[model samples]
Target: MEYLIPFNRPFLTGKENEFVNEVFRTRNLSGNGPFTKKSQAFFENRFGFGKCLLTTSCTDALEMAAILIDIKPGDEVIVPSYTFVSSANPFILRGAKIVFIDSKNNHPSLDENQIESLITKKTKAIVVVHYAGTACNMELVMSIAAKYKLYVIEDAAQAIANNYSFSDKSKKFLGSFGHLATFSFHETKNISSGEGGLLVINDKTLVERAEIIWEKGTNRNAFFKGIVDKYNWVDVGSSFLPSELIAALLYSQLQSLDEIQKKRIAIWNQYKNGLKEWALLNDVEISYIPEYSGNNAHIFYLIFNTSEKRDNLILKLKNKGILSVFHYLSLHKSPYYKDKHDGRELVNSDRYSDCLLRLPLFVDLTEKEVTHIINIIVN
Candidate 1:
């Protein structure tokens, strides 16, 4: 059924076509062209990140990370089972065993406290997802990684512009905390191209090697730099780069990021304020951002008292020409992995799986449309 209000509608900043036209004028349609380099450099300089490699999708970035860390059979990687499949798949594909952790009782972020207990001699890395663009407790994660000599991969797919705060009253962007991190520019994300992703390398040691892996296991990037007379296949990798056109489109969105963020945050506030009273009276909980996290307003979701209540609300909203939706099913219990799972009960992961609902959120959603959604859900 077509609804008056849908769950999501991708927003455009009006400069996308002009940039694409420039790419055409230059006649470079392949990856790592002028637009691609400019976009990569923009992210590096703006975020203070080390070498950045643009990819076709966040999944590709994560896959590159798995290869970089040399994940292999019998190796274990710790990750939250509450996240999307991409968070775990890359490592799993590399023959690494996934050690799924539960979410914290308060938020969907990984229960960092449970991480150490999951680590073993076979543990190679910890993949942490900053769910809903909220920051995870990086201090604890980093300290633990240091203690065990493990790699930390921040699956910052939803955390493009969010910051992680420290007790010293200083802040670091979410993707910068881990040795390696990934970000998404999918249409549903805060800033987007049609489909794009970035791999951020912070270890410095990994920078040179990452380029080789990014260039389809070749030294082409080095050869182009005149660092080598000719390039050859040097390691394992793939064609992860997006076309110059995609980069051009993404660069246009990045230009207006601050303005887009302003509108999104305003819409997010409208939802929170509009529903706060009703949520309390009805015994429901809206999305919560901890003080240590910066809000990017990436998504607005609610946790109902029970799965039944959540399902009922969705049906009621649907009847009123509105579309509300649920999020990921707990991966540990998924049919594909249940037999392989160690069978530890991930209570909070299951709780979120059954009871959480995501509401309409996008840059183009008007106050009137938001009000209509709020009023329908309130009643």
Candidate 2:
């Protein structure tokens, strides 16, 4: 059942092995070693993030953020219903109640206008996912959070190496605007360490505590920084850091990010241009890019008029040895959360749950192969 074209293939920058070998030579495979520092510095210097720490996965980073923010039972956190489970799961684990936000009609990001109405006295935070690397309206989101005095965490797992335009014609990285942000370097993401995550602390006040939470609730980082003579457990935390080996591989990936993004954007453009006419004729919806968001090319998805058409198309592509797949189901309607939902329908989230289809998108996917995929889909 091996499809000639898989849904995703992790790209290698060729320097990964060399970097990992260097880590082995340093004889420090532990977390927060030389390789980890190099990787973290790369992000901080490149994105101007306040402070960055690598974690085992994005979920762990979010969990650390949850702890830093002091989430408590009965506290409410607003999250988009069309995102991966990790976006809400971390808050839920801290006993915070999740208030699901609906997606925008023509885009997968949460409707920023609806965020204000969902806040309450008990609301503690708003978690925004920059779906497909396109930003949610950061200006409005931050303003609302200020008005309500709520925390904002950007689940920028797919948003690395991308920019968000401001209303003043200024721009910044997607992960920079939120008080705390998390990113993934999963094999399928634009960047890869196979299994790694990052937490960016934009709020200066949270920086010191975030480091404590990252080191399993200890002042271990302070000790290393020579700020403390002795380090001991001081708070609740977990083993959130990834091994130095993962960071080594990631540093290599970071070195080639521009090259990788260039190729990915080209692939996304091919899909858009190739399918434009076919989409209009078939009454289907192709990828949508908001003017304020950079096209990071994290995904190029299609939406059929009905789930049947999307499913049938996936099956058809499979028959041709091409792998195509559906994206997230609405979290509010999921079996685990169905009863927990407030009975309010999130129409756009539900629509994407059924109609959205993701095609093969990887660095190795060539122009000829893309054309072939387009030809099959159209005919």
Q: Report lDDT per candidate.
A: 0.93, 0.94
Model 2 stretches astray by more than 4 angstroms: none
**Per-residue lDDT of 249-271 in model 1, one digit per residue for the tens?**
99999999999999999999999
Residue-level lDDT tens digits of model 2 in 1-379: 9989999999999998899999888889999998899889999999999899999999999999999999999999999999999999999999989999999999998999999899889999999999999888888999999999999999999999889887788889889999999999999999999999999999999999888888988999999999999999998888999999999999999999999999999999999999999999999999998889888999999989899999999999999999999999999999999999999999999999999999999999999999999999999
Q: Supply candidate 2's per-residue lDDT for 148.
A: 90
Check candidate 2 and list the clashing pairs: none
The C-alpha stretches of model 1 lying farther than 4 A from their native spots are none
The weakest ten consecutive residues by lDDT in model 1 span 42-51
